[model samples]
Target: MTLADTLKGMIGLDPTAHADADMKAVLAALKELNPKPIEECSVAEAREQPTPADAVRKLMTQAGHAARLPLEVEAVQSEDTVIPGAAGSNPARIYRPAGDGPFPLILYFHGGGWVIADLDVYDATPRSIAAQSNAIVVSAHYRQAPEHKLPAAHEDAFAAWRWIVESAASLGGDPSRIAVMGESAGANLAINVAIHARDSGLRAPLHQALIYPVASNNIVSISYEENRSAKPLNKKMMLWFVQNVINDEGDLKSPLIDVVSADLSNLPPTVVVTAGIDPLRSDGEKLAEKLRDAGVAVEHRNYQGATHEFFGMAPVVQAARDAQTFVSLAQRQAFGGVPLEEAP
Candidate 1:
């Protein structure tokens, strides 16, 4: 079978399967594809079976193997930089493209609901975007929810963008060519950051790329109801994340919590991607309509036969790569030409 077919088979397993057996099969798949075996696997095997989260992480690691990512790209050097925010510190990795004077910049947030994923976890996707898009990538490591709470992640995200704008010249990125991009909850953060930027009268992002973002405050979208138990990301996990992020139900209606409810006028050009079987699909589609109605240039596409988190699982499927390519191209066009001192 093709790699995609194999991936479909593996991820298609019942989510309610025995955790141990499921993890074993997932580990075996990773072993087949050659993974950086974690020592915890042996430790966990000797103890009580892995949790569902553990199983999902293992599956995601295997999906990394299934991605069509160009494994060998000229490495863009990165350094950890701390950016000041409203709440506290937001750490970011500054990716400088090769031969760059001042490349266009992309501020990336990772998807892990609002809690789980981190900058290192989503490293490959950003690297691919940097290499293919030929732009500097600043991956934001925002504070997770439950620990940071609602508006904390959002505050840090906006602060990271502000810091990028303030320090762009020093970091070899065009301040005028700043774009915001994220996946899943990160995508949610990205859209909300644009909302903040627009409302605050600060210069908005030149472009925004949200890959199947969580855009609704309400959890009644068709995809949410249909794919509630889908693998990689599920309804319970999503609600859990959302609950942890927001303090009260009242916060849910706040424009900060739901960009779909916010005024989308005067926003930047947007490329919104939605997955066929993702619960968050309708939110993105709705957000796309709002942006267009507000006169923002928008290109929205839904990838059929894919699930949530497909954008970051580049190792498993071509759909992920294709989406990245599309987003990168859109960013390039939206930013026009990078007026850097050197070529990126």
Candidate 2:
């Protein structure tokens, strides 16, 4: 039989079956937490549900991979601090490189649909960014929706960005070479922060890495249909998130919320990452296209067989490891714009 025929014979012919085995394994482990469906749960209940980070740790520990990690992974130092915002303050974690002296600074934002998740739930990605790029990463949590509502997270993100720009130097970071990185809803905030920096004449980010951003409002796109029931994130869950964040239809027209329709010119070099099995795949892809059209330098990487939240599952998923490496290399290039050899 042909290769395709043999593969079909072994694992059936369902398109959904094309998902990575490791990704499915993590999803299975996530299901073990018995989370109520997002559309069916209260905001508090949704926040209490098992996060993708939990699933990654669960799968690794269960498979006996936790004990195999290199001890050097602990070299990076992490400390908790508070980022002062207009309304109040948000908790932030700063990760410093092992062998560092004024390293490049990266301000990271966590994805939770602007309704759930936090810095702790997103610990892996920022730590991985620090370990791989040897840069200082400050991952901060913004206010969520239904309680704080729309623009609250965005306001907090800007506050965090401004704080990072003003304080990175004092924190042993090279403020001249700063970057922004985020996943899902947080990606939405990262790009907007870069824009706000340009408008405010603040120190602009040198680069931005957005993973599976919520760029376009077109939730009926192909990925939504293809992965309508995707685990961790889906069309139904997105609708739930939207309702919680937006007070009304007018909120949808805000340039901060309507990212795809906003001006994207003169932004920093960007890296947009998309997962093949994710509902936000088209969102990232479309954002990348918009950046290119606006004369911005952009690189888009679509990880086939990977799902949303896979970027933080490096310990249990190969694709996650590869994605981490890709982002780290991209961030390093933006930091120095130097080639691999003949330099420090």
Candidate 3:
């Protein structure tokens, strides 16, 4: 088996056939670049207040161009669904989905290095996932960094999750069938939510879907060194984002920011998706290993050729579709046993 194929076998998960060409191409491309180690990267910077509207506009514009997937999923938009949040901040958002009878819900955190993302910009992608998984997807608008640091995003994540658990019924969702999902920095938040749920005495999600997650700000993993300059989500951008998100070195060491070394014993079933060409690939792999070692039911998928943020590019890539299928199946299997599955 090729290296990617070998890794899949090691984890007891299957590789999607669509990733074949992409994986091969990416591996070849990386060999040509001869990337530097993650340690060579600089520390992430602190966040600062700027006109965020311009940043949001640019990202949404890029997403619009990036979104080539046809609108095949039925969807609805919601605004300002409140959740108890940290001091002076009440997290809220827009939700989207199809079907009416208590669907599985996804409490989604958006990626913008944890400093720039917003609901309106990421609405379509969550809407797609919700439709594909038949889940009610809530796009959480959390406190951005530079102003809010490590614990702030973690706090908002927990609050939103609690809100979903308590108010799932009103949103036409089954409280027992919720999942937490995100990409890049948001993926880190989703993983944090899962960890917190298991440790905080709160209701745990049925599943956790992490798309090219950032499990550490350290960037010491093999993939980080190998794909430091990988397009879309590079190591520099990652370091910059982390620097902005953490309050200081101590905060950087917090379990919420450093998931790789964090205790994984209580996390729920998880599906971690990585791109063969992405720097964060090793983060996802290592997390899956840690979770499995901790006796959690975890599945890892590495899509070749696709690159970072492939999950959001479902509009044009077959790999993204296959991933959605895999996650949907996993979500159903996880919730199938809950007593609430039979509730009204």
Candidate 4:
């Protein structure tokens, strides 16, 4: 038996007890890879850890499927551009669908706890979103932490949104129908951009889709307690990320960081997605409740048997596929138009 199997046998842990069948399979395959625990690794080592996509690609290769790193979707055209930011210029990639008059725009942010990962590591999501929703997708890359620190990524996100709004027409996107969407830390930025736009009297997003967002700094909620040891994201790993991003403890309470404390009034219609096995699940739930209480239209969905980082694993995880469908449907309804093609 593998070391992971031996460990499981010794601990009497059943994979199905916490995750769905497909997720169990993923976990098993991942365990066989014998990756080092993030908590015990240095920042560089943690950053080099294999992502779920990497593991899935390996599994597929082992199963006789062709290995395709950074899965691609057929967008009619894609271009990379640089957007000016407070610190420096940020790189952004825009994806346009085929035969588009002026498609609705989705300003997408990728998740990396505001530190690791980048547009290249998360190419599959925006590609899939652009193809599935037939919208112009601008995937933005922001400055990371321990070098740039907290609030830098947030500022870069708002700057990217502003740039998109100002240049939407040139990008073949309708400014009036623009939306903000992201996963994990990117989701935090998406909501913050909406709030910033509303407060700044700029053109607010028509909608915001946040997938497994980091909504609050309080990590003692029931979900956190239950999933503190969850793979991909755990409490210890989160603490490491927090330490790397924030300058000090005081930043934890900032409204931009602790979104539950932020004024949610008059924000755009919102959809918050949560994973059943993620520590941040309660964060999403609390943020949704706060948005609704502030009189904003809100839709919250918690996918059972899903774990953190599952949002971008649609190629392997059924729950992720379902979540992606939910996100695309929400975007379509918010954009107030039929998709260029029906969502699968």
Candidate 5:
């Protein structure tokens, strides 16, 4: 049996019947790439591991699809730039759909557990969001772990938020109508950005789209126990990420890291997304619960048969399309703009 099948079999989960067919294909492709486990690799080795996005691209290319999915997913204007960070400067990418007037801005973050992956690895989601949500999307990259551990990324997130807020207008976006977005660990950064803004009396994000966020330091929750062997993102991988980023056991309790234990009061309206076959599913669900309990407006959507990092694979996954629409509609309403029509 293949490594993917062997792993799934060992966990008593049937890949073919457990996840969506399309999602299964992507997972299989990723497994076929045969990267070392995050727990078993050096930081450099981990960074080089084939990602879910790569799997999506490979499938698209092999299927005789059009180009590498920036425009294939949705047509939007894109540019690369640099932004100031808590440490040295970091890189950023901006996505704008066809338009004349300034559009609503979304300061975004890509997920790699604060270690691997960069702006290029996460191009699909922001590009799609720009068109469907009628907003300009600015995706940011921060310092990574094993080199720049916890709070390094957090500080950079705040710096990126500060930069985006001031420069939105210059980029053909409305500074007054702004939001924040991210996937997985990046979502953790996004919410912390909002909390930082509220505490510092800075401009607030109208909404936050948190896709499969790393909400808590709790890695042994029910969902974690269940999807501990799920592909692309299992409990072991999540633990590896935490281990690399934190300096000590105490770091796990920091509000910035254990966001579920942080203050959720007065944060923006939130969209918490969860994948049925993900270790962080509990993270997303728990954060949503805490947000609502803290009196923030919450819209939580859990897609069964989907996996972590599926948010950006809409070009190959139907759940992704539905999620894109769900997030777009939510953001449109929050920005007080006209309703966003379905993506063409």
Candidate 6:
């Protein structure tokens, strides 16, 4: 048998017993690709690693299905702009649903462990959010690590958030109804943005939706140990990302990075989404609880059979679809719209 077949057999008679069927299938496909561990690969090589969305797209195409493209919402138009930043300017993409008046705004951050992925790699997420929530989604393309390093991306994220808040009205967005949303590293930035807003005496985001955020600097947590070998985002990859992003281990203690230990009070209402098989699952769970303890209105959901990056694979992963729906409903309610049913 081939190596993948051998590995699949080793998992158990039914590999899907512990994971969603689609998640298992995607992991199998990823194994077939045999990507090198991020720690052992150059940044360029690591960038080639198959994302969950990539795995799903490949599987669909191999099965004679059309490739799933970013959803196009009717009346929604996207535009590219350069926002003034600490460093000259930052590139951003804005998605606005078709409407005459201002709409709720979401300042979105894309995840790549703060290193590799770019705005294009995460286009589907903001597009989906904009379409589903009928809101404006402004996705920032922040400077990456090993090139710009920590505090750089954080500065960019906050600057973008500040700029959007000030320019919301000009862009057809309602500043009063703005929110922050992101996945993984982006989620970290989203939370930080909310924290910064609150501390700076700026109007905080109405809500924050974090999908499997990297909340803690500690990598030895229970979920980290349990999902050390998880596909898409293994512990080693997480470490590699940390190494590239931070100047030294001392930087880990910074509140901007170690969000779990940061002051969480006075932040906006929050929704924390975690995947069962993701190494960062515990981080999200713990952050939600801490937020609640700090008197922040919080909602937490953990999808039992999903993996890291599953939130962006909605075209094939049912859990992703459900998670997106959950986020959209949360955004709608936060924006003063009718709420849909909560996620199952």
| Best model number under lDDT | 5
Arranged by lDDT with the best first, the candidates are 5, 2, 6, 4, 1, 3
State the displacement of the C-alpha of residue 332, model 1, in Å, after optimal TM-score superposition. Answer: 0.5
Better of 4 and 5 by lDDT: 5
Candidate 6 weakest ten by summed lDDT: 7-16
- How do the residues 146-247 of candidate 2 rate in per-residue lDDT, one tens digit apiece? 999988999899999999999988999887989999999999999999999999898899999999998877876767767777777777899899999998
Task: Give the range of the ten consecutive residues with the poorest summed lDDT in model 4.
Answer: 7-16
Position 344, candidate 3: lDDT: 20
Could you tell me every candidate's TM-score relative to the true structure?
0.79, 0.92, 0.76, 0.90, 0.92, 0.90
Q: List the residue pairs that clash in candidate 6.
A: 75-98
Off by over 4 Å in 6: 1-17, 64-75, 340-344
> What do the candidate models score in CA lDDT, each in turn?
0.72, 0.86, 0.69, 0.83, 0.88, 0.85
Query: Which tens-of-lDDT digit does each residue in 1-344 have in candidate 6?
Result: 86555544444233234888877877777767777777898998888876666667677877643446444554568888888776979889999876666899999999998998887788778888998888999999888898989899989998998898999999888878999999999999999999999889888899999999999987877677667777777788899999999998899999888898999999988999999887899899999998999999888999989888888777777898899988889889899897645423
Per-residue error at 60 for model 6, in Å?
3.2
The alpha-carbon deviation from the true structure for residue 310 of candidate 3, after best TM-score superposition, in angstroms, is 1.3
lDDT of 1 by residue, 1-344 (tens): 87545544544344324323332344345345443222222322312333322433556555433323363344667777777877777777777667746788888998876766566667766777887677889998888766778888888888887888888888888788889999888988898888888888787899899989888876766666666666455666677677777888898898776777888888888999997767788889999998899999899988766666666545445676678777878887777753222324
Candidate 5 clashing pairs?
Answer: none
Weakest lDDT window of 10 consecutive positions for candidate 2: 7-16
Q: After superposition, how far is residue 46 of candidate 1 from its true place, in Å?
A: 20
Q: Write the per-residue lDDT of candidate 3 for residues 23-101, one digit (tens) a residue.
A: 3333334344443333343323222222122222233345333334445464455566566765555556746564467
Total residue pair clashes for candidate 2: 0
How do the residues 1-344 of candidate 5 rate in per-residue lDDT, one tens digit apiece? 86555554546564335899888888888888887888888888898888888898888877544234445335688999999999889999989887675899999999999999999899989989998888889999999997998889999999999999999889888899999999998999999999999998899999999999988888767677778777888878888899999999999999998899998999999998898988888889999999999999999999999998999998888899889889989899889865445424
